[model samples]
Each structure stands twice: as C-alpha cells, then as structure tokens.
Target: ERSGASMAQPETTRVFLNNVDSYASRHIAQVTFEACTDSVKAAALISDVEAELVSNHKRTFQVVGTVSHPSAVERPHRLDRDELLSKLMGCDVVIYNVTQHADQVEEALWAASALHSEVEHFSGPKMFILISTIMTWACSKPADPDDLELPFTDAIFWSRRAHPNFERHIDLEKRVVKMGKTVSLQLFSTYVVAAGLQYGMGEQIFHYFFKKSWLGEDGPVFGDGENIVPTIHIHDLASVVCSVIQHQPRPYYLLAVDDSNNTMEEIVKKIASVLGPGKIQKKPSEDAFLTKDLTDSLLVSLRMEAAYIKKLFSFNWVCQFGLVENIEVVVQEYRQSRGLLPVRLCVLGPPAVGKTTVSKKICEYYRLHHVTVKGTVSDTIARLVSSLLSPPNQSELSTLNRNMNPAGLEEELLLNVMRDELMTHPCKNQGYVLEDFPQTREQAKELFDGKEEDLSCVATEFVLCLEATEAFLLDRVLNLPESRVQEHNCEPENFSRRLAAYNEKQSEDDVVLNYFYEHDIIPLQFGNPNAEADCLPLMQKVIDMVGQPRNYGPSSQEVKEEERRKAGERLRREAQERAEVEQMEADEARARAARWAEWTKKLEQVRQQEEEELEATSRPMRGYLMEQVVPTLSQGLTACCRAQPQDPVDFLAEYLLKNNPFEA
Candidate 1:
C-alpha cells in the first residue's frame, strides 16, 4: 500500500520514488537540451519524457543517488550512494535505472547491500528495478581465423560489439533477486531518433556529416545495408520509463520496443528526402566502416551508432515528418527569437548634398541607426592642421617645416596626410549615409581598386555629386570668414583669378557627377538646396536602379554637356570683364595722346617767337659802332644759347620714362 492513497483498492500501487535522479533525469528532465550539445533523437526523447511527467504524472523527482566512476563525465556526483541510502531508508520503493558504467552499477549494488544489512530495525518492502540495454550483449561477427582475439578487446571491435560488463549487471540483478525482496530487471533495446536537424543543438549526426564534407572529396558514411536502425521518439521513451517506474512490471522481463525499425539506408534516404534530393551521400566500398589504428590512434570509421541507454527506453512508433517540415518549424522559431526582420531604406545623393538630412528623416521613419561616414580629405586635413597649429608650439613648427620647402609648402603634402588619416579611420557599420572621401578620380581609384570587379569593397554605398553655378560658388567663397578663407587659401579679391586657374587645370572627367549611374564611381547631380521634393524621387529611382549590379562605362554625353555648360559660363564672364577693361584702357590712351599733342604745339609756337626776337636783335643796329655790333652779337649768342623751351614731346616722353616706366 502506498502512502496518502485510497486504502480500499489494495492492488492500486502508488510508488513514491523521490529524488531518483540519473543520466535520464539530468538530460530527460524538464529543461530542453541545447541544440548544439545533443543529438536530435536524444533531445526529442528528453523533451517528450519531461512533458509527459509534467502533464500526466505530477511526480516531483529530484536527483537522490547517482553512482558514477571518477571519470564518468555523464553522471552527476552530488547524488552519491550514501546520500541515496539515507533518503530512501524510510521510502517504500527504490526504482534504479542502471545505464551508466559497470563500476557505478557495482557501487550501487554494494550500497544497497549495506542498507539492507545495516538497517535491520526499518521494515520496508523495498523493490529494486534495473533497466538495461541490449547493446550490452550484441557482438560483431569475427573476421578471419588468424584474427581470433577477444571480440570486444579492440576499440573498433568494442564500438559495434555489446558491452563486456553486461554480466556484471546481470550478476547484480541476481543478487538483489536473492535478497528475499521482489526484484525486477527490464532489459530494454530502444533507439532514440532525433526529430530534425536544428541550429546550435549540441553535436549531432548532421553536424558530423557537414563537418566531414569539408575534410576531402568525399565524407565518411556507415557501411553494411543489413544493420537495422530502431529509433524511439524522446517523448515516448520518457513516457515508457515513467510508466515502468510508477507500476512495477514482472521480474526479469526483456522489454523490446522499436519505434521505427528501418535499415540505415532507409533512414538516410528519409533524411535526404526531407533535406531535398542529392543530400545523402554514399561511401566508397573500400573503407566503408571506420577501423582503429593504435599507432596513430585514429578511428577510421567516424560514424557510431546512438548510445545504448537511448535504445532501451524506446516508445511506440509515431508518424515521422520529413526534415523539411522540422527545418521550417525550427527556422521560423529561430527567426522570431532573433527578431530578424526586413528593412526599408531611402538613400540620399552624394556627399554635401543634404544626404545627411534625408538619411536622418529616413532613419526616423524606419526607426534605424543613421550612420554617416565622416572625414573627407579636406576635413581630415583641416583637423590635422588644427592640431598642428592650435597651440602654436614647437611641434606645430616641426610638422610645417618637415613638409615645407625653402620657398613654401605645397597643398598636396597636407592632402596626402589627410588621405592617410582617412584611410586609417574605422569603417562605419550602421545604416547608409554620405561619405566625403574620394573627392578626386585618382583618390577614388586608389581607395577602391578593382571596383569593376566588386563594388562592395569600397567604403561608400553610393556616390553623389553636388552641382552649383560658379557664381554661387564664388559668392560662397567670398562671404566666408577670414579664418575659413585663409584655411582654404582663398582670397575674395582673387576669386575670379583663382577660379579661372582652377577651371583650366580641372578635367571634366575628373569630377564625379551622377556617381550612381556610372559603374566606376557613381555620381548623382543635385540642384541647390538639394530639396527633398526633387531629390527624394530621384533618389528612390537611383536606389531601385542600384538594386541590380551594373557596369557603367566612362562619363556620358550628359555629364560632358553639364561640364561644358559650366566652362562656357566661366568663359562668358571672363570675356565680358576683358572687354570692359579694354574699353577703359582705350579711353585713357586717347586722353594721354591729346594732352601730349597740345603741349608739342605750344612749345613749337614759343620757339618761333624766340627765333624772331633773336633775329631782330642781330639785325645790326643801323647806326652804332663796331663795339656795339660785337656787344649785340654777344647778346644774340647768349639769347640763342638760353634753353629755348625744351621740346614738349621729348620732355613728356622723358617724364613718362622716369615716373610711369611701365605705361607703354
């Protein structure tokens, strides 16, 4: 009679096996095994047993006693024989599931013997139950007469052969049977069949096969079409174990239950069918089964049958689903658990084209990270310059001096330094955004070599070009603060001059406009303000276009036309300025010529008058003596010698040479 039960029904037995833990309890307990750790069959069995125990039988069993050899990695140590006997001395039933090592089984038997002998005062009808696997008896057929060694002595032989310690288990059973108490030993031959291949489930046959696929041309496979594989669903296995524990069966009964008794080929075929055609591979006949080599200590045939304990606790056969169905369920569950979902994106144009603003809006709408690639050559250079120049210390002087020539430093050195810094910076991983690298064609080519082969290697998702009128650029440059102007080395007064030089040096092909359309470095052209109304729709179209891979050739006619238009605009402005300057110079030359002509005429008139005066004085006084004539001649000579108004034309030419030497 069981405690806390209806006394009227004496045949109805309620066995209270408290804390009867073992390998079954640790694995086949309520908790599910991790996918990576155990076979699918093992997991299914454990899960099934746990479910039945929780739903049908409200039996709370904790691990009480587990006898394991010091090296047994499978059994728990906290529930040793001493602890088990102490807890079960007063208990009515002792349900023992002996599936571990032989030494453990021997220890349990010794503990039981001690409990029975030492505790004479306690009178309890203790029933000992032993569950064993048929694997402990099955042996492989001998090879040749010469190879007549003990069948189970070799590692390869023991792998397929039954356990050599089966006699010890049977001997223990006989001893218990002789103890004057009822003893039942259930010899079970059950096989655990995993439900399906899953991700991260502890080691399994599928993983073993997949890993083998990487080894060589062909992977390992099981041999012999005759070996029949019997599998039991984990849940059913647990149910059967629980059933045997609750209602004690007849003593010394071999319970042979096979869920599905199919050959290895049939099982492989079923797995292949679920996984799809051509999934299962056959092994070569030469080395069909793995053999052991002591010198190398290698197991030739990697495939091994499922452990014996799993085979003994098999349940009734249930309609098994193919791998596809199981995989679909697992995939769905994994996806849901990981929160992996589809993404919606809206990519803006190239650098400096309001892509950041648009990206922020898109991210806000989609609730995603708005990642922007910062650090253009210019920005990097500016930063480097800032660091070097900020304190105005010795280091700053050294850096500048290192790059500087005796005359001056070139801008290219600073740009190179900036490029190096940018290349070294970490890549942005979040969502899409603008990057300001690759400002030039050469830089782009350097940064993204073999872009024609693969675009993903490049740092940017898409390339965009921001277009603006030269006038607009000039205005922007001119209005910048003194510090900014100095930083870029741009002077407002020299704006037109520098622009002309820049345009002359810059190539139309060098510019990256509509970077997306072009395969090399896609360029996108955007108007001023880069308004969303205009740009968003274009961006959407570009996004759709970029979905497919493309091989864009050199710059198109449209790009050339746009560049030509800009060049024409610059030429027109320059032509107009040149014409105005020419007109001003012509007016100044005419005015200077008129003034010189007036001065020349006046000088000539003055000289004529002086000559007449001199003639009149030399005309020899009609009267007066020789002395007066000589004196008059002296006066005429003095008057002639006096500088008679230097020639104004010559004077003016000389004056211009001394004062305005460059004036032609």
Candidate 2:
C-alpha cells in the first residue's frame, strides 16, 4: 500500500491490508520494497493468501497476520467492525483490494465506514486506497460510440458506468469517494484505483491461456476474440500504488493500465509464438463466463488510457507499451517466477565412453530427470507386454496390434517411448538428461515431430558428446575388473562390436550429430585422455552459457558429502600410487641382491677351479715322475740330497729329460 506517511516520520506508517492473498495483493507486497521509504510496514488482515507470496517479502516487509478464518465464518477474528476499527486506528493507510471477488466489495465498504466514523479522532493523516477492477467500466458507453477511435480515459471517470454484474463494486467505489468528500478535512483522503487485467509474474486471469500455450495445446480464444483487453503488468500496477502513496495525487479516481490495444486473439497468438505452436481455437463467449468470475474478466472490452495519471503522475513506467511489445520480458518473468524453464540436455557418446555416467552426473547436479535409451526402451517393452498379456478388452488389444509389424515393433515402440518420455511433465518442467537416444537423424526428426532446424518447442538446449579413441575404449573395457565388465555388459568382445557400430554411426551422414549441427547447437565434445577430470569444466561452461539453473542445486549437506567423496577418491589414488612405488622399489632391491649373490658364487667357483687346475698340473708332474722320472727323479733327488743344492734344479730338469728319453 502506498502511503503519504514518510520515513522521516518518527512513527511507523502502519498499513492495514485486506485480501492479502489476492493476486494483486501478493504483487503489491513484493513491490513494497521499492517504496521510497522503509518506514511503511504492513499489518495484513488474514484472508486466504499464499504462504510463498508472503514468505518472499518477509525479510523486507513485516507482514503480521493470523490464520485464515474457518469456512463457517465470513471473515477472520479481526473482521468485527470494532476490532477492525481498532486495527485501523493504529494504521495510517488502509488498502482494501476488491479486484478478486464480489464478496470483497462488502468487506471494503465496512472498512471505509469504520474509517469514516473515526475521521475526527484519528491520530494522523489517514488515507484509504481502494484497488478495484477494470471490469466495472466494461459496460460504459464510449464518449463517441460511433467514432470507436476514442478511448475511455480517467478524466471522464464521472461519466463512467459499471457493468451490471459489478454494480456492488461501483457502489463501494462511490462510498469510498463519498467518505473522503464528507470528511472534508485535509487529514482524510480516499483513492479508487481501477486496475486492468494483470498479466505478469505467472499471470492471474490469463494463466489458463498461458499454461495451455506452454503445454503445446491450442489456446482458446472466446468468441471472435476481437474484444479489446485492457491489461497491466502486476509490477506496473504496484508502481502506481507506490506513486499514489508518495504523491497522494488530487484525483481520487485513477486508472491503472498500459497503452496496448491488443485484441484477445493477438495476445494468445503472441504467447503461443514464444511458448508453443502458434495455434488458437475460438470458442463461444459463454464458455468464458462459465468459469470462475475472476477469469470471466478476460472477456471485458475496454480501450483504456491512463491519461489522467500521465498528466498528474511523474514516475518511470514499466511496460507502458504493454504486453505484446514487451512479451519477451514478460514471458521470461513468467518462466522464472514459476521455475518452469527446463535445462534440457542430450548426452551423446559411443558405447562405454561414459555417456550414462556423465548424464547421471548432470541430472544430479541440475535436479533433472535421467532418461536413458535403455531404461526407456525397457520400460516401454514391459508396458507393451503387460498390456498385451492382460488384453484390456478386445478393442484395446486390436488397437495395440493393428497393422503392427512384429519385425518393426521395436523401432516404432522405441520412438514412441522416447517421445513420450521427454514430453512428460517432469521432463518439461524440471528438464532431463537424455542419454544415447535418437541414434540417427530420422529418429531425431520423429522425436521432435519436425526437421532439426524447425525444433522450436521441443528442442534440447545442449548436446554433449563424450568421445574416446576406439583403442582406448577397448583397452579401458579390457582393464575393467571382471565384475564391472559384466555389470556394464561391455566384455572386450561385446564392447568391440558396440564400438564398431558407434564408429559406423559416426561415419554415417544421417547421424544425430548432423541433426544437432544443423540446428546450430554445437555439442560440448569432451574426448581428452582424462575425461573424468574434464566433466566439471564441461558442466561449468554449460552453466555459464545457460545462465542460472531453473531448479535448486545441491543442498549444503549434499555438497559436503560430494566433497568428502572426492577427497576420499584423491587419497585412495595417492595411496595406490605409493603402494606401486614401494612394490617396484622392493622388486629392484631383491634383483640387485640376487645379482650380487650370483657374482660371489661365480667368483668362488673360479677360485676353486684355479686351485684344482694347479693341483692337477702338479699331479700330472708327479705321475710323470712316478712312471719313468720317478725312479730317475728319486735318484736325482737322493743324489741332489747327497750332493747339495746348487745343481738340484738342473738335476731335476736332467731327470725329466731322461724320463722323456725313456718314453722316446
């Protein structure tokens, strides 16, 4: 609620808000932070309101309220006139937003009456801001009915008439204005702001159309759809509220609207252009009136101008030209506010190159669904078999089997399953990491129901390709433990066959890679030797390009757990390296000791053999002496012994020669 009360005021400008849960009130609460002064605080009179709406503003604004009234009661405990007046006595501004329902009109008048009764006794300058709907002026005859070019401006608010159904609302507006006029004092003022159909921040009245378009359904346009719809962004309406609070303009009646002259059909078509197939279907005008009263306001035909506001107000305008011209901005607001945007990713890779693993990681990080070809195919086959076995009546069985070729069932079923899987609400809203599906261009076309370039509605935002050399992949499979190899079904022989098929697909002209390329979605190709380490960098690049995530990320506990896991992995790898180094050193030390022992043994053998050779040579000499030289040597020895010595060596040589002569 905008207030004339200033931050400079020593006391807080307490605001009494009714219908706090209404679409307009929620947005109004959000924009309160943008108020010129932080001194204005709100005391919300509890009604049926969304908790999320208030929770978002809790930090910035003090929203005091109790639980909603029980179904048996017309209002909460503070609805008593005396109790309400007591609540109002403490507040400087009373914002009664009656745009939501006919019931709120009565509630607002009661508040107005309470304030009027206490006009003289109020402690400070009190102002009442009434948030009304543009539908009240739906039945007003234009200034020049035939001219048609002239719009209904707020300057001629006195001449305006209310729609028959909204007479109660108009009555309340008059009562609010009358209270201000009767008060006459400068301290009391009342303003009635007739807000147009609001259409931003997930929308309100137009949500049915927005959601239908986003879901790829034909948006329904009531009747000829030629009726002019006056609309305002919720934020802009909030801004008008703020302006009224700060400026307290003299005009008691203000029209909150934009300058767009868009027909109902134009708005839906524009929404479809950005969200879904641009298709619209026209229905009877009565069909719109059949829904809730709030949505029935969409059929209101009003060409409105905020000329009075433009002349009196001086503030920046958001969406002044309105929704059609600023659709891209509005659509983004819708997507982000509701967290409806999906981070669609397709992970492509050869067999055993870690496509599934990488896709799982992506899904975990982004809170996306993991849709693998194998899982989808398996689920589809199971469903088909179960349905066939049960035979849910003959007609369904016939429909299931009709013209179905047993040979081609696998291919056809796979395509259908993948299409349905990706289009599921989980995948559409939260996004999915699809792994190794749509192996060929034809399959991609079938899945998207369009040529690669024409995929506007159901296109994957990113395509990630994980690659490795065929030799490297085969070696990797070979090196895997036997249990792991079995678990992945990638035993060396089987992996080779699958890898060969993948290589063949890569070589083909009609592969899915070409589809992605034609769509101009360049794949993040990760093929380095250390692909495991590259995953984080690849994800970071994608995140940077994609901007913020559409969903919440890992919780603090999850992050800590992941960190611990990584640290554990690092420690294990280090320990393995150390163990390998120690084992190698031990092997080298044992080898060196064995070589030394062998060398020592060989040296001992050589030494012993030399000794033996010496002995043998001596023996041979002794044998020779024993045969012929023995007798001669003995005699030579004896003669040498008897004769002494100087000639002993010569005597031995002569004895040896005598022995040789005997041999000759």
Candidate 3:
C-alpha cells in the first residue's frame, strides 16, 4: 500500500459506443466518444444496461456524448462529413450502430471505410458492426431452400446476402482487412439485444403487451413462432461487445447473443405473463405479409450459438437473466417504456407424401396440439353433443339424428366443425394438422373465408408434403389383402379409373398450393420412389424442419385435467357422431341409388328415342327385285367376268337360268 510510485494517472481510453452508448457505459469505465443515433439511445445513460468495455491497449474509458446530429441517412445536411471524420479519426475504437436505421447501413459502412482510409499500420481503430438474427436467416438460404437444417452461426450470417442491410457487415470486413493486417473487423450476430425501456426490443415489447390487453393483439406471430432466436439483455450485449473489445476477436465475425434460445411465442407469452395475464394472438408466418415482408429482419427467426466467440475470448454472460428469471426487469422496463413489442406455418405436399405421419411428428416435436380435419369434426361433434345435451333438446337434437340425412348436411356440419376447430381452443390456441380436408383449393378457400364475419386466424404453420412414386402409392392404396377386402371389391380397372380421378383432384388442388404459396406457405416436397423405409425419414425431416418451440404451453396437469373433462362427455358425443356418420353413409347410399335409378330411366328413354328415330329414318326396300340376284351374286363375279363374253342376250339368259333371275 505504501509503494507510491504515485500510481500512474489513469489514461482515459476512447471507446466509441455508437448508438449503444446507453447500454455500454455501465460495463465500460470512463469512455470518450459521441453516440450518434436516429433517435436518442434508450437507456443510453442512467438505464439498467451494464457491460465491461475494456481493450488490450486501453483500460480506463470515458464515453462522452458531445455531438448531436440527425440520422446521416435521412438528414445528411445535419452531419458535417469533415467534422465527423475528424472526430472518428481521434477515436481509438469505432462502433457503428447499424441497428437503428436499416436505411443507414451504407452510411455507416462508408464512415468505417473513411476511418479505415485515414488510419493505417498500428494506428487503425478496431471496428464492430452490430447485426440482428434475421440477417442470419436470410444469409442461410441457398439456391434451394430445402436442404439440411443449419444453425445461424456468425460465419454464415456475416457474409451472406439474404439482406442488404446486413451486407454492410461484409463490406466493413472487407474494408478493414484491406487496411492491411494491422486493422481488426467483426460482425456481431445478435438476436434481440435489449436497448432500454425505450430503445431496441424493450419499447416494442412494452407496447405489444399494453395494447394486447387481456384479449391479445390482432397482429400475427411469424411462422407459428417456431423459429428460435438466440437472445440477450442489453447489458449482456454490451458485455459481449466489451469482451470482444478486450480480446480483439480476429478472423472477422462473432455471434453476440447469449443462450436465451427463445421463440417469438415464448418471448411474447413471457412478456404477457410479466405484464399480467393476457392472450397471445398466434398466426402463421405467411399471414405476417399482411403487415411485413417475408424477409423482414425482425420477423425472420435465427437460433445461433456464440461458440467461436465464446471460446476465442473466454466470453461468458456477465449479467444473468433469462425468459422466466428476468421477469421483474422486463416488467419494470416495459412499464418504464410504456410497454410495446413487435410480435412475432403447414404441412402441404403432394399426394401420398407422408403428410399426416409427418404432421404428427411435427406436433410431437413441437409439443403442439396435433389434430386432423376428421378428428376436429369428432371434437366438434363431441362439443356439440355436450352443448346440446345440457339443455336436453330431444326434438331439435333428433333433427341431427341418424335419419337426418348425413350426406346433405355433411358440408354444412364440416364448415361449422372446422370453424370451431380452427377458431376455438386446443386447435385454435395451439397447433394442429389439417388432414384430408381442404384437399381442394375451393375447400381451403372456404376454410379461410374472406366474407365470414368471424374469420379463422390460425392455420397450418407448415405443410409436410410427402411424395412417393405412382407405383408405391397405387400399391399402397389398392393392395388390400383378400381377407381384408369388402363386398364392393376394388378391381384393377376400378383402381385405374380411381387413380385417374385422383390425379384430376390433384390438378384441382394446384390452385390451393398457389394460393397458400402466395401467403408464403409453400409445400415442402420430400420424395421417396419406394415406400420401403417405413416412414422414418419423413418423420425425422418433419422434426428437423419444425424447429423446437421454447418451453411453454399447458402443463401436464392442465392437459390431464382437460382430458378428464372431455372423456365422459366424449362417449355420448361419440355415439351421436357415430349415428350422424352412419346417416351420412345411408344418405350417400340413397344418393347413389337415386342416381343409378335415374340413369336407368334415362338409358331406357334413350333406347326408345333411338328406336323411334331409326323407324323415322327407315325406307321401303327394293328387295323383291334384288332377291333373285342372290344366288347369281353368290357365284364368283370373277368367274362371270373371266368367262368368254357372250352375246348380251345369251349371257343374260344363261345367268338367269343359273341364278333364277325370273321368280314366277
């Protein structure tokens, strides 16, 4: 304690925080530099954000905001390019906050490029570009969207062109490296880095929850909120930045998010819970286009691991708070910010593509409510039975009885059943597979009726289209064993005709696929010429494709209680449904019988009409005179021709004698 070499005065280090000043100050000590932003950085100062901003060459830091200016992209007039470049040149580190104005990516990159040009050798400042997870998702796409499931890593997102805003990172990296080996460059693969109660996702979350109230918002959740986004608190982001600053991470890009692998649904639900009880309006990603583009960075989902960065710099999260644990902080911030949040798909495939089986696996993997159209009808019937039984409407209920004619009412019943299934709980609140229903485009269009007063909001998030060869599908559809066969046997000819009809139905469904695709719900085709592999690959792919949802949903006890409540009621309802289905069968039989009888009558009528027409077209025969010529004609005409030409009369007489031309 007494060794007073008069501890050398703490040399102030200049660390540029860009728009991140609010969140970075706590983690870094005294730092010097102005943080230019479109809007003032939320929690830019005196907020809860905390992170260390230290580097190898510098220790103490002083972050001072001296310059006030407009967004360089919008108000280039406000920014004195020369003065800004001078200020940048004086700084030891340049952090370009590209997150605020996506339109300013080029401006930021240009600023970095200018800074790189001004400095060289041992003088160049280290640069960091902060980017979001959507950049990564866009980058991950190949010429073919369907390939192996890949992770959103720093390396991939840094250079990819899925987004132009993200291209700034690539440009900066190239520019910095071009400054020769002395300079360093980094692109941060960030998820939702909380800025403050007012900035970044905090404001969005705040508004989203507040507006949602208890009924939930009218906005849609992207891709059924299945895509996982690696997230971090603002303080964590600053700490990550500071850690990178200190270590001077090299070889370019690094992931900046922590281990909070939350889905949009999870985050929204958590925010909802924190704010107080409320509902989350979940819809398919395709539906998001009603508000946003398919490639909108905020809407794209990216699950990343900061593996390389973590290992390279011994980086770890300094501030620990997660989805559940950070509730208090989130609530406080949300309230402070006046609460908001930008809220956050489908098995569709061709015939015999293991759609149903894959859908089951997808629901299983995601722990969603797996239901089919038929099952939904049963559920609806069960619900209907319960609804009708409590009041005991024997008369009207009998109208729904077996004798009510199922065929005539099936479409109407299904419309109601599907409406309930799609718009009510279980299927409504959670995910479900629509099978064997909406097989045609018209039916699908009916399901999402534009004219309906109360529309169905939720639909299949993903369509797992299973494909197999014609031979395989036919064999599977037709190869029922003799023992398993029934009265109206499926003969080869019938199978051919049915297959042709099936193809025609598929052709009709082309419009359905086109419609869904326009809504960004394209069919994911997985094909197997031979169905020998027992449906395992299809299931695996479904699981792989249907990214895991964050941990939430009805707990085991809740599900059990629901099951218990439905069981007793389901029995009576099942009986009613059975009766209704049987009636449908009977009605269908009668329809067929009627059609057959009408066809028979038409056939007889056609026969009679044809006979009358034939009689009308008939004429008297010139037969009596020609009858004597039969025997003469039967004798070879060639012989008559070959015989020596006789005198016309003598030849006629000889022919008449042989052929009996003269009938008495």
User: Each model's C-alpha lDDT?
Assistant: 0.41, 0.74, 0.50
Best by TM-score, which number? 2
- In model 2, the runs with Cα more than 4 Å from the true position are 1-11, 38-79, 292-294, 348-432, 437-495, 500-664
* Candidate structures ordered by lDDT, highest first: 2, 3, 1
Distance from true position, residue 623, model 1, in Å? 99
Q: Candidate 2 residues 475-536, lDDT tens each?
A: 77777778878878797687878788888988987888888788788888777434454567
lDDT string for model 3 (340-364, tens) is 2111045654444345555565566
Model 1, position 361, has a per-residue lDDT of: 53
Clashing pairs in 2: 2-245, 3-245, 625-630
> Total clashes, candidate 1?
30
C-alpha lDDT of candidate 3 relative to the true structure: 0.50
TM for candidate 3 is 0.39
CA RMSD (A), model 2: 23.0
Of 1 and 3, the candidate ahead on TM-score is 3
Better of 2 and 3 by lDDT: 2
